[model samples]
Target: MSCLTARTGRQRQRYEGHLRLVSGCIPYKFEKSVGGSNCSTEKDLLVLMISSPSRDDLVFPKGGWEDDETMSEAACREAWEEAGVKGVLGETPLGDWEFRSKSKQNSCSLQGGCRGFMFAMEVTEELDSWPEQANYGRKWLTIEEAYRACRYDWMREALKKFVTALPESRENDTIKELEERPLRPISEVEHQMPSQGCFGSHPSIQQLAA
Candidate 1:
Protein backbone atom coordinates (compact mmCIF):
# COMPACT_ATOMS: atom_id res chain seq x y z
CA MET A 1 0.00 0.00 0.00
CA SER A 2 1.10 3.60 -0.80
CA CYS A 3 2.06 5.67 2.28
CA LEU A 4 -0.05 8.87 2.64
CA THR A 5 1.28 10.17 5.96
CA ALA A 6 1.65 13.94 6.55
CA ARG A 7 5.37 13.93 5.59
CA THR A 8 4.97 11.56 2.63
CA GLY A 9 1.98 13.37 1.10
CA ARG A 10 3.78 16.71 0.62
CA GLN A 11 6.15 17.31 -2.24
CA ARG A 12 9.71 18.22 -1.29
CA GLN A 13 11.15 21.59 -2.23
CA ARG A 14 14.77 22.15 -3.19
CA TYR A 15 17.05 25.12 -3.16
CA GLU A 16 16.91 26.82 -6.56
CA GLY A 17 20.35 28.46 -6.62
CA HIS A 18 23.89 27.36 -5.84
CA LEU A 19 26.41 29.25 -3.69
CA ARG A 20 29.73 30.55 -5.05
CA LEU A 21 32.99 32.23 -3.92
CA VAL A 22 35.14 34.29 -6.26
CA SER A 23 37.83 37.04 -6.23
CA GLY A 24 39.59 39.55 -8.54
CA CYS A 25 43.14 41.00 -8.68
CA ILE A 26 44.07 44.10 -10.74
CA PRO A 27 47.74 44.99 -11.39
CA TYR A 28 49.25 47.77 -13.48
CA LYS A 29 52.88 48.41 -14.41
CA PHE A 30 54.66 51.66 -15.45
CA GLU A 31 55.37 51.88 -19.17
CA LYS A 32 55.55 55.60 -19.59
CA SER A 33 52.19 56.79 -21.00
CA VAL A 34 50.12 55.48 -23.86
CA GLY A 35 49.82 57.39 -27.19
CA GLY A 36 52.97 59.35 -26.37
CA SER A 37 56.18 59.57 -28.40
CA ASN A 38 59.60 58.61 -26.96
CA CYS A 39 57.78 56.26 -24.62
CA SER A 40 59.93 53.53 -23.08
CA THR A 41 59.29 49.95 -24.11
CA GLU A 42 58.81 48.92 -20.50
CA LYS A 43 55.22 47.95 -19.70
CA ASP A 44 53.34 50.47 -17.58
CA LEU A 45 50.46 48.24 -16.43
CA LEU A 46 49.99 44.58 -15.63
CA VAL A 47 46.94 42.88 -17.16
CA LEU A 48 46.16 39.88 -15.01
CA MET A 49 45.41 36.66 -16.84
CA ILE A 50 41.79 36.47 -18.00
CA SER A 51 41.75 32.76 -18.74
CA SER A 52 40.04 29.84 -17.02
CA PRO A 53 41.97 26.91 -15.59
CA SER A 54 39.95 24.26 -17.41
CA ARG A 55 40.32 25.91 -20.80
CA ASP A 56 41.78 28.85 -22.74
CA ASP A 57 38.59 30.80 -22.01
CA LEU A 58 39.87 34.13 -20.62
CA VAL A 59 39.05 35.39 -17.13
CA PHE A 60 40.58 37.84 -14.65
CA PRO A 61 43.31 36.54 -12.36
CA LYS A 62 41.43 35.20 -9.34
CA GLY A 63 40.55 32.07 -7.39
CA GLY A 64 39.03 30.59 -4.22
CA TRP A 65 40.18 31.92 -0.82
CA GLU A 66 41.13 29.48 1.88
CA ASP A 67 39.43 29.53 5.28
CA ASP A 68 42.56 30.61 7.16
CA GLU A 69 43.41 33.61 4.96
CA THR A 70 41.75 37.00 4.58
CA MET A 71 40.41 38.26 1.23
CA SER A 72 43.35 40.67 0.96
CA GLU A 73 45.85 37.89 1.46
CA ALA A 74 44.03 35.70 -1.04
CA ALA A 75 44.17 38.39 -3.72
CA CYS A 76 47.87 39.10 -3.22
CA ARG A 77 48.74 35.42 -3.05
CA GLU A 78 46.72 34.64 -6.20
CA ALA A 79 48.51 37.37 -8.11
CA TRP A 80 51.90 35.88 -7.27
CA GLU A 81 50.81 32.28 -7.50
CA GLU A 82 48.80 32.65 -10.71
CA ALA A 83 50.64 35.47 -12.49
CA GLY A 84 54.06 34.98 -10.99
CA VAL A 85 54.24 38.59 -9.71
CA LYS A 86 54.32 40.26 -6.29
CA GLY A 87 52.96 43.59 -5.14
CA VAL A 88 51.24 45.46 -2.33
CA LEU A 89 47.50 44.69 -2.18
CA GLY A 90 45.06 47.56 -2.36
CA GLU A 91 44.15 48.98 1.03
CA THR A 92 40.38 48.53 0.52
CA PRO A 93 38.48 45.93 -1.41
CA LEU A 94 36.91 47.25 -4.60
CA GLY A 95 33.81 45.10 -4.18
CA ASP A 96 32.32 41.63 -4.56
CA TRP A 97 31.14 39.96 -7.79
CA GLU A 98 29.19 36.79 -8.60
CA PHE A 99 29.26 34.13 -11.33
CA ARG A 100 27.59 30.74 -11.82
CA SER A 101 29.25 27.42 -12.59
CA LYS A 102 27.60 24.15 -13.58
CA SER A 103 30.61 22.08 -12.63
CA LYS A 104 30.19 23.06 -8.98
CA GLN A 105 29.94 20.06 -6.66
CA ASN A 106 30.35 19.15 -3.00
CA SER A 107 34.14 19.23 -3.29
CA CYS A 108 33.95 22.76 -4.71
CA SER A 109 32.44 24.60 -1.76
CA LEU A 110 32.75 28.13 -3.09
CA GLN A 111 31.40 27.15 -6.46
CA GLY A 112 27.93 26.33 -5.19
CA GLY A 113 28.31 26.92 -1.48
CA CYS A 114 28.67 30.58 -0.52
CA ARG A 115 29.22 34.17 -1.70
CA GLY A 116 32.63 35.47 -2.81
CA PHE A 117 34.79 38.63 -2.76
CA MET A 118 36.77 40.69 -5.26
CA PHE A 119 40.03 42.25 -4.01
CA ALA A 120 42.07 44.97 -5.72
CA MET A 121 45.80 45.89 -5.63
CA GLU A 122 48.70 47.76 -7.29
CA VAL A 123 51.79 45.89 -8.49
CA THR A 124 55.28 46.89 -7.32
CA GLU A 125 57.29 45.00 -9.94
CA GLU A 126 57.17 43.19 -13.32
CA LEU A 127 57.09 39.43 -13.05
CA ASP A 128 59.84 37.66 -14.95
CA SER A 129 58.02 34.38 -14.48
CA TRP A 130 55.24 32.83 -12.42
CA PRO A 131 55.67 30.37 -9.58
CA GLU A 132 57.20 27.06 -10.58
CA GLN A 133 53.90 25.31 -10.02
CA ALA A 134 51.82 28.07 -11.59
CA ASN A 135 50.33 26.87 -14.88
CA TYR A 136 49.09 30.37 -15.75
CA GLY A 137 50.91 33.27 -17.45
CA ARG A 138 50.56 37.06 -17.29
CA LYS A 139 50.00 39.44 -20.19
CA TRP A 140 50.25 43.20 -20.72
CA LEU A 141 47.30 44.72 -22.54
CA THR A 142 45.82 48.15 -23.04
CA ILE A 143 42.83 49.13 -20.91
CA GLU A 144 40.64 48.65 -23.98
CA GLU A 145 42.10 45.25 -24.73
CA ALA A 146 41.63 44.12 -21.16
CA TYR A 147 37.99 45.16 -21.18
CA ARG A 148 37.34 43.36 -24.44
CA ALA A 149 38.85 40.14 -23.11
CA CYS A 150 36.61 39.89 -20.04
CA ARG A 151 33.16 38.23 -20.25
CA TYR A 152 31.43 38.83 -16.90
CA ASP A 153 29.68 42.17 -16.33
CA TRP A 154 31.26 42.69 -12.90
CA MET A 155 34.79 41.97 -14.06
CA ARG A 156 34.48 44.17 -17.16
CA GLU A 157 33.12 47.04 -15.11
CA ALA A 158 35.89 46.78 -12.54
CA LEU A 159 38.62 46.75 -15.19
CA LYS A 160 37.12 49.73 -16.98
CA LYS A 161 36.90 51.89 -13.86
CA PHE A 162 40.42 51.06 -12.72
CA VAL A 163 41.90 51.68 -16.18
CA THR A 164 40.12 55.00 -16.59
CA ALA A 165 41.44 56.35 -13.28
CA LEU A 166 45.03 55.88 -14.41
CA PRO A 167 46.98 59.10 -15.05
CA GLU A 168 47.61 58.03 -18.62
CA SER A 169 43.92 57.57 -19.45
CA ARG A 170 42.20 60.13 -21.63
CA GLU A 171 39.66 62.56 -20.24
CA ASN A 172 36.07 62.97 -21.49
CA ASP A 173 36.28 59.47 -22.96
CA THR A 174 35.01 56.86 -20.54
CA ILE A 175 35.23 53.56 -22.45
CA LYS A 176 38.45 52.66 -24.21
CA GLU A 177 37.14 50.47 -27.09
CA LEU A 178 34.05 48.44 -26.15
CA GLU A 179 31.30 50.28 -27.98
CA GLU A 180 31.51 48.69 -31.42
CA ARG A 181 32.96 45.36 -30.36
CA PRO A 182 30.98 42.12 -30.20
CA LEU A 183 30.78 39.84 -27.17
CA ARG A 184 30.08 36.12 -27.33
CA PRO A 185 27.46 35.03 -24.82
CA ILE A 186 28.63 33.34 -21.62
CA SER A 187 29.61 29.78 -22.51
CA GLU A 188 26.98 27.13 -21.90
CA VAL A 189 29.62 24.89 -20.43
CA GLU A 190 30.37 27.51 -17.79
CA HIS A 191 26.78 27.91 -16.66
CA GLN A 192 26.05 26.45 -13.20
CA MET A 193 23.59 23.55 -13.18
CA PRO A 194 21.56 21.80 -10.50
CA SER A 195 23.37 19.39 -8.25
CA GLN A 196 22.52 15.68 -8.44
CA GLY A 197 22.55 15.32 -4.66
CA CYS A 198 26.01 13.81 -4.97
CA PHE A 199 26.84 14.85 -1.41
CA GLY A 200 23.28 15.00 -0.05
CA SER A 201 24.12 18.58 1.00
CA HIS A 202 21.42 20.94 -0.19
CA PRO A 203 22.37 24.61 -0.02
CA SER A 204 19.71 25.47 2.55
CA ILE A 205 19.43 22.10 4.23
CA GLN A 206 22.41 21.72 6.55
CA GLN A 207 23.13 18.33 8.10
CA LEU A 208 21.69 18.60 11.61
CA ALA A 209 22.46 15.04 12.54
CA ALA A 210 26.15 15.26 11.61
Candidate 2:
Protein backbone atom coordinates (compact mmCIF):
# COMPACT_ATOMS: atom_id res chain seq x y z
CA MET A 1 0.00 0.00 0.00
CA SER A 2 1.13 3.55 -0.74
CA CYS A 3 1.84 5.85 2.21
CA LEU A 4 0.92 9.02 0.31
CA THR A 5 -2.43 10.35 -0.87
CA ALA A 6 -3.47 13.60 -2.59
CA ARG A 7 -5.64 16.00 -0.65
CA THR A 8 -8.85 17.10 -2.43
CA GLY A 9 -10.44 20.52 -2.82
CA ARG A 10 -9.07 24.04 -1.99
CA GLN A 11 -6.90 23.12 0.97
CA ARG A 12 -3.38 23.42 -0.45
CA GLN A 13 -1.57 20.10 -0.70
CA ARG A 14 1.34 19.89 1.70
CA TYR A 15 3.36 17.05 0.21
CA GLU A 16 3.63 15.62 -3.30
CA GLY A 17 3.48 11.89 -2.68
CA HIS A 18 7.08 11.35 -1.57
CA LEU A 19 8.93 14.58 -2.23
CA ARG A 20 8.88 18.29 -1.43
CA LEU A 21 10.18 21.13 -3.57
CA VAL A 22 12.58 23.68 -2.09
CA SER A 23 14.94 26.43 -3.19
CA GLY A 24 18.19 27.83 -1.83
CA CYS A 25 21.29 29.91 -2.61
CA ILE A 26 24.99 29.35 -2.50
CA PRO A 27 26.24 32.76 -1.36
CA TYR A 28 29.83 33.53 -2.28
CA LYS A 29 32.32 36.37 -2.65
CA PHE A 30 35.83 36.82 -4.00
CA GLU A 31 38.28 37.75 -1.28
CA LYS A 32 39.41 41.31 -1.98
CA SER A 33 43.15 40.93 -1.22
CA VAL A 34 45.85 38.32 -1.01
CA GLY A 35 48.83 38.63 1.36
CA GLY A 36 48.14 42.36 1.86
CA SER A 37 48.02 43.21 -1.86
CA ASN A 38 45.43 45.91 -2.58
CA CYS A 39 44.17 44.05 -5.63
CA SER A 40 41.56 41.31 -5.73
CA THR A 41 42.48 37.66 -6.22
CA GLU A 42 40.22 34.97 -7.59
CA LYS A 43 42.22 32.27 -5.80
CA ASP A 44 40.66 33.39 -2.54
CA LEU A 45 37.00 32.88 -3.38
CA LEU A 46 35.00 32.26 -0.22
CA VAL A 47 31.55 30.76 0.36
CA LEU A 48 29.31 31.56 3.27
CA MET A 49 28.36 28.59 5.49
CA ILE A 50 25.86 28.61 8.28
CA SER A 51 25.41 26.45 11.35
CA SER A 52 22.19 24.47 11.07
CA PRO A 53 19.71 25.31 13.76
CA SER A 54 18.86 21.68 14.48
CA ARG A 55 22.39 20.40 14.55
CA ASP A 56 26.08 21.40 14.57
CA ASP A 57 26.59 20.63 10.88
CA LEU A 58 27.64 23.46 8.58
CA VAL A 59 25.44 24.17 5.57
CA PHE A 60 24.58 26.83 3.01
CA PRO A 61 21.61 29.17 3.50
CA LYS A 62 18.40 27.86 1.94
CA GLY A 63 14.70 27.44 2.62
CA GLY A 64 11.25 26.84 1.16
CA TRP A 65 10.23 28.92 -1.86
CA GLU A 66 7.21 31.04 -1.13
CA ASP A 67 4.46 31.04 -3.80
CA ASP A 68 4.54 34.85 -3.99
CA GLU A 69 8.20 34.94 -5.14
CA THR A 70 10.13 33.49 -8.04
CA MET A 71 12.76 30.80 -7.41
CA SER A 72 15.61 33.33 -7.61
CA GLU A 73 13.79 35.73 -5.35
CA ALA A 74 13.20 33.00 -2.78
CA ALA A 75 16.88 32.10 -2.80
CA CYS A 76 17.85 35.73 -2.30
CA ARG A 77 15.30 36.14 0.45
CA GLU A 78 16.55 33.01 2.22
CA ALA A 79 20.12 34.31 2.10
CA TRP A 80 19.11 37.57 3.75
CA GLU A 81 16.85 35.90 6.27
CA GLU A 82 19.24 33.14 7.25
CA ALA A 83 22.66 34.72 6.71
CA GLY A 84 22.06 38.49 6.71
CA VAL A 85 23.66 39.05 3.33
CA LYS A 86 22.50 40.73 0.12
CA GLY A 87 23.76 40.78 -3.44
CA VAL A 88 23.11 39.89 -7.09
CA LEU A 89 21.52 36.50 -7.74
CA GLY A 90 22.49 34.48 -10.75
CA GLU A 91 19.74 34.52 -13.38
CA THR A 92 19.42 30.74 -13.06
CA PRO A 93 20.14 27.90 -10.72
CA LEU A 94 23.63 26.39 -10.89
CA GLY A 95 22.12 22.99 -10.12
CA ASP A 96 19.89 21.05 -7.76
CA TRP A 97 20.21 18.29 -5.13
CA GLU A 98 17.96 15.97 -3.16
CA PHE A 99 18.12 15.32 0.55
CA ARG A 100 16.05 13.90 3.34
CA SER A 101 14.80 16.52 5.72
CA LYS A 102 15.12 15.91 9.44
CA SER A 103 11.66 17.30 10.02
CA LYS A 104 9.72 14.81 7.95
CA GLN A 105 6.22 15.34 9.29
CA ASN A 106 5.92 18.77 7.74
CA SER A 107 7.17 17.62 4.33
CA CYS A 108 5.33 15.79 1.58
CA SER A 109 7.56 12.74 1.56
CA LEU A 110 6.85 9.68 3.61
CA GLN A 111 10.61 9.60 4.13
CA GLY A 112 10.94 13.38 4.50
CA GLY A 113 12.68 13.74 1.16
CA CYS A 114 13.11 17.13 -0.54
CA ARG A 115 14.58 18.48 -3.73
CA GLY A 116 16.29 21.85 -3.80
CA PHE A 117 17.13 24.24 -6.59
CA MET A 118 20.44 25.92 -5.86
CA PHE A 119 21.46 29.28 -7.29
CA ALA A 120 24.66 31.28 -7.02
CA MET A 121 24.53 34.67 -5.33
CA GLU A 122 27.40 37.12 -5.34
CA VAL A 123 27.26 38.67 -1.91
CA THR A 124 27.67 42.47 -1.83
CA GLU A 125 26.68 43.34 1.74
CA GLU A 126 26.76 41.56 5.08
CA LEU A 127 24.44 42.80 7.80
CA ASP A 128 25.26 42.74 11.49
CA SER A 129 22.06 40.86 12.21
CA TRP A 130 19.32 38.90 10.49
CA PRO A 131 16.02 37.10 11.15
CA GLU A 132 17.69 33.77 11.81
CA GLN A 133 20.62 35.23 13.74
CA ALA A 134 19.45 33.71 16.98
CA ASN A 135 19.04 30.26 15.43
CA TYR A 136 22.04 30.07 13.12
CA GLY A 137 25.71 31.01 13.09
CA ARG A 138 27.43 32.15 9.88
CA LYS A 139 31.01 31.93 8.64
CA TRP A 140 32.89 32.49 5.41
CA LEU A 141 35.17 29.65 4.28
CA THR A 142 37.53 29.03 1.42
CA ILE A 143 36.47 26.61 -1.32
CA GLU A 144 38.38 23.61 -0.02
CA GLU A 145 37.36 24.32 3.54
CA ALA A 146 33.73 24.63 2.55
CA TYR A 147 33.87 21.42 0.59
CA ARG A 148 35.21 19.51 3.54
CA ALA A 149 32.88 21.20 6.01
CA CYS A 150 29.70 20.63 4.05
CA ARG A 151 27.26 18.33 5.82
CA TYR A 152 26.07 16.52 2.69
CA ASP A 153 27.70 14.94 -0.34
CA TRP A 154 25.36 16.70 -2.77
CA MET A 155 26.43 20.05 -1.36
CA ARG A 156 30.07 19.07 -1.88
CA GLU A 157 29.36 18.45 -5.57
CA ALA A 158 27.77 21.88 -5.86
CA LEU A 159 30.84 23.47 -4.28
CA LYS A 160 33.08 21.63 -6.73
CA LYS A 161 31.06 22.91 -9.69
CA PHE A 162 31.36 26.46 -8.40
CA VAL A 163 35.13 26.17 -7.95
CA THR A 164 35.64 24.67 -11.39
CA ALA A 165 33.69 27.45 -13.10
CA LEU A 166 35.52 30.33 -11.39
CA PRO A 167 38.17 32.09 -13.45
CA GLU A 168 41.76 31.27 -12.56
CA SER A 169 42.50 34.90 -11.79
CA ARG A 170 41.07 38.33 -12.37
CA GLU A 171 42.88 41.54 -13.25
CA ASN A 172 43.51 43.85 -10.32
CA ASP A 173 42.19 46.83 -12.25
CA THR A 174 38.92 45.08 -13.02
CA ILE A 175 38.52 44.18 -9.36
CA LYS A 176 39.13 47.75 -8.30
CA GLU A 177 36.63 49.04 -10.86
CA LEU A 178 33.91 46.71 -9.68
CA GLU A 179 34.60 47.63 -6.08
CA GLU A 180 34.32 51.31 -6.89
CA ARG A 181 31.05 50.79 -8.74
CA PRO A 182 27.81 50.86 -6.82
CA LEU A 183 25.60 47.80 -6.96
CA ARG A 184 21.92 48.29 -7.68
CA PRO A 185 19.30 46.41 -5.70
CA ILE A 186 18.72 42.90 -7.03
CA SER A 187 15.07 43.68 -7.67
CA GLU A 188 16.11 46.39 -10.15
CA VAL A 189 18.19 44.01 -12.22
CA GLU A 190 16.47 42.31 -15.15
CA HIS A 191 17.35 38.80 -16.32
CA GLN A 192 16.92 38.03 -20.00
CA MET A 193 17.42 34.61 -21.50
CA PRO A 194 19.16 34.36 -24.84
CA SER A 195 17.00 33.15 -27.72
CA GLN A 196 19.12 29.99 -27.61
CA GLY A 197 17.18 28.65 -24.60
CA CYS A 198 16.79 28.44 -20.82
CA PHE A 199 19.63 27.48 -18.51
CA GLY A 200 18.85 23.76 -18.75
CA SER A 201 19.47 23.93 -22.49
CA HIS A 202 22.96 25.40 -22.03
CA PRO A 203 26.09 24.32 -20.21
CA SER A 204 25.65 24.75 -16.46
CA ILE A 205 28.93 26.60 -15.94
CA GLN A 206 28.38 28.82 -18.96
CA GLN A 207 24.96 29.76 -17.68
CA LEU A 208 26.51 30.64 -14.33
CA ALA A 209 29.18 32.77 -16.03
CA ALA A 210 26.47 34.60 -17.98
Maximum-TM-score candidate: 2
Clashes of 1: 16
Off by over 4 Å in 2: 1-17, 36-43, 104-109, 168-205, 208-210
Q: Give the per-residue lDDT digits (tens) of candidate 2, residues 13-126.
A: 234556666777778887765564665443567788887766646778877765566777667767877777887776667777778876664666467677777877777788
Clashing pairs for model 2 are 15-108
Q: Which candidate number has the best lDDT?
A: 2
| Residue 15, candidate 2: C-alpha displacement in angstroms | 5.8
TM-score of every candidate: 0.61, 0.67
Summarize candidate 1's per-residue lDDT along 1-210 as a digit string, tens digits.
Answer: 122111111132122256435454776655564454765454445455434555644555665655555666666656665655566565455555555552553363544543445444555654454442234545565565566566657677666555544455452153534655676444522321111101111132111110
What is the Cα-based TM-score of model 2? 0.67
